[model samples]
Target: MDGKKVILAEPRGFCAGVRRAISMVEQALDYYGPPVYVRKEIVHNHHVIRALEGRGAIFTSSENDVPEGAVCVFSAHGVSPEVRGNARGRDLRVLDATCPLVSKVHQEAQRFARAGRTILLVGHADHEEVEGTLGEAPASTIVVESVEDARALDLPPDADVAYLTQTTLSLDETAAIIGTLRERFPALAGPATDDICYASQNRQNAVKALAARSDLVLVVGSANSSNSVRMVEVARNAGTASHLVSNVEDVDVGWLDGTTAIGVSAGASTPEFLVDQLVDRLVELGYDGLEIEETATENITFTFRPVWQTEEVVQP
Candidate 1:
């Protein structure tokens, strides 16, 4: 196609929470020296994890792997109370990096549980965030991944229930599931605020806007990043072809064969450098024209806890 263009979505890549989380790890490495232990994938992006690892951050799936009294930073996805307890028992010097948004969801779960309501958590069950949220009140929480799952809930219509969502879910999809719950349980309770994170909502809306005018959409993020996958889904649901591009090498030339306008966006946890690389590759392939699709302006920033900047350990 002649004069093919790249339409980049505004407010894409490295949301405030991600920036805070990554910065905490880097700061820890600098202050605590090499081999600062981190639980989980930090923020679900391998590139970020690898970069931190190169700088002496050690990632482990379990807190037990961290040596006693070593510095350990929690991932942005957050951890369950049990995980926190385990870390404490090890006497690990902890630095919490959980995104404030996800922490809100966890608080909602605990509050609902305290009220003796059966909490219905909506999102992919296998996701790290979902797993951690579920652990908040495992005995009283049910994981609902889809509207179909909501429909199949075995609870009575009048059962006491409250629903919370994984922060990084597709806004439309989460709404549908919540709608289903409301229809089934007239007395269902929910968070005073929307559980979906602002970054996710903004990125999804931007992707839909991009899908409206582009021949194809490419979301830059790791495969495991829920928000990035949701952006791709948002574009496809808007009737545009979309794919998740982990990096420039993942782009298939055939997808761009006749595409005149390709939309580009990155997940919340993605770094802008990946987007730059993808854009550079697209330019080399002759899609040099560039336009920005500004659906939203994100000026939010998250600050690290006081303990993250000091030598004192943060009690879990």
Candidate 2:
């Protein structure tokens, strides 16, 4: 609608993990010449991936596709032990970019397996993170993506049970799934701390706050981005009409037909540039005013430098 206001959510776009992953690729490119191979989309943001690609990083779906001795960086989603082993067998110089939170899940999985417990992983079956975590203890872990899955999961009668979740998931939905799991497995052991990372929870909370005050919500993120997709769901669940767009081109003008207030938020992996582009597009589409809703402040940062660096700056 003409002369409508656009509300933006703070703590949107680029979580610490995504920032670290991108920086890993950039640093790798700078430290080790061109063609630094990365396995999988670093963080599911096309713009971020393209920016790195332009800077001479090559992305591959499998380690086998990479030259044996070339430096390879794993995606933020993390990788299976099998993938790690395969890379090691090939003697690939590896730099893991898995988020520390996700690594926490992996460590829990290892502990549960070592304790001879059956692990229930709460996430989509095919997601790279789930696949990697599943690989952690394939024989002892089962993937459950929904409350329904939790309800119908048939586990060994006497098997000790525990659960770990994907870092980026709809908070309420995951909570419901966990509720069902606890109901069924009275003895289930969950993470000592919540597995859903702080960034995911904060972003969703921010989007819910933005969606409540706006007539419509626009989520800036790739379709495959778990956190971005969950943000859209969170907004809709808050009773606001929400659309998840990869970029300005994906924003449907028809959704603005009668909306007077629109809110914009980005996924953890999305770059600020894409958010700016989306806001600019909204202005072009007749939303002239802008307001930012600050739900929380993010002071967290992560950094990594080569072992040879004389001085490495790690921020928090």
Candidate 3:
């Protein structure tokens, strides 16, 4: 393993959305004291959830779990209107931390429903963001999980339809599925801009590039992170071995036994510190030389706005 080098990819971790979501929790804790109830993991990263838990953030699967009049923050994945209604019923001081990009998608869903168009939402049906978006027009929305699902649609050929995609999905795969849908539905409309988040797209592109020359590529992100898993898939599709890891502890030393070169990339929700630790561990394993593969530069930042910017505004 001696003298082996590792290539890190640019724009690998902490997209603006995740950064803004994490900051909302931390800032809520700072301004409102301990016991800030956050509904669901603020982002997909467990390490991030644990860190915030240590800082006095309480995570609950449902907003109904929060006590009356307590502070509750929605996750970055956004929430269904039913969840928001539940929060209101509980009289919790809600601080919605949903990513603005996600919010934009939600607005589009509502607009399409108003126009009486059946929606073809492209994503994993069970993801929270998908669930939330589906709630916008449950009667009018259809979940498109794969090309097979797109083909199995029972709607009429001339039906009015609009297509919206999940923020974190395999770009190539999604494109292929959309192509199938386009062939089947001539009047299909799409979002004004691409729905795949910029961070997700950049990270996946970098992983594809890294996989081209590296013997093995390690992606640092939790299993639940969609973008992270997609990055690994992209690498594998590029004809290289790839693994999804949460941190340095998850990196198996054996993968490097005979490897001369390695590639590392992270999901948007992953913290840079995790990548730093992975690099350090790789160094210890004899893959010392490091180079950052410049694929893209990200300078985006999101500013958060609470439902009500006060420590004690009880109703929302």
Better of 2 and 3 by lDDT: 3
Which ten residues in a row are the worst by lDDT in model 3? 307-316
The candidate, 1 or 2, that scores higher on lDDT is 1
lDDT of 2: 0.89
State the lDDT of candidate 2 residue by residue for 1-316, as single tens digits. Answer: 3568899999899999998888888888888779899999988988888889999999999988888777888999999989988887777878889898999999999999999989999999989999999999999999998998998988754458999999998899999999989888888888899999999999999999998889999999999999999999999999999999999999778998889999999999998998899889888878899998998999998777662241112222
Q: Could you tally the backbone clashes for each prediction?
A: 0, 0, 0
Q: Model 2 TM-score?
A: 0.95
Cα RMSD of all models vs. native, in order, equals 1.7, 3.7, 1.7
Q: Choose the strongest candidate by lDDT.
A: 1
* Count: clashes, candidate 2: 0
- How do all models score by TM-score? 0.97, 0.95, 0.96
> 145-233, model 3: which lDDT tens digit per residue?
99999999998889899999999999999999999999999989999999998988999999998998799999999999988999999
lDDT of candidate 1 over 44-137, digit per residue (tens) = 8989989999999999989999999899889899889999889878888888888999999999999999999999999998988998999999
Worst 10 residues of 1 by lDDT: 306-315
Error of 2 at 189 (Å): 0.8
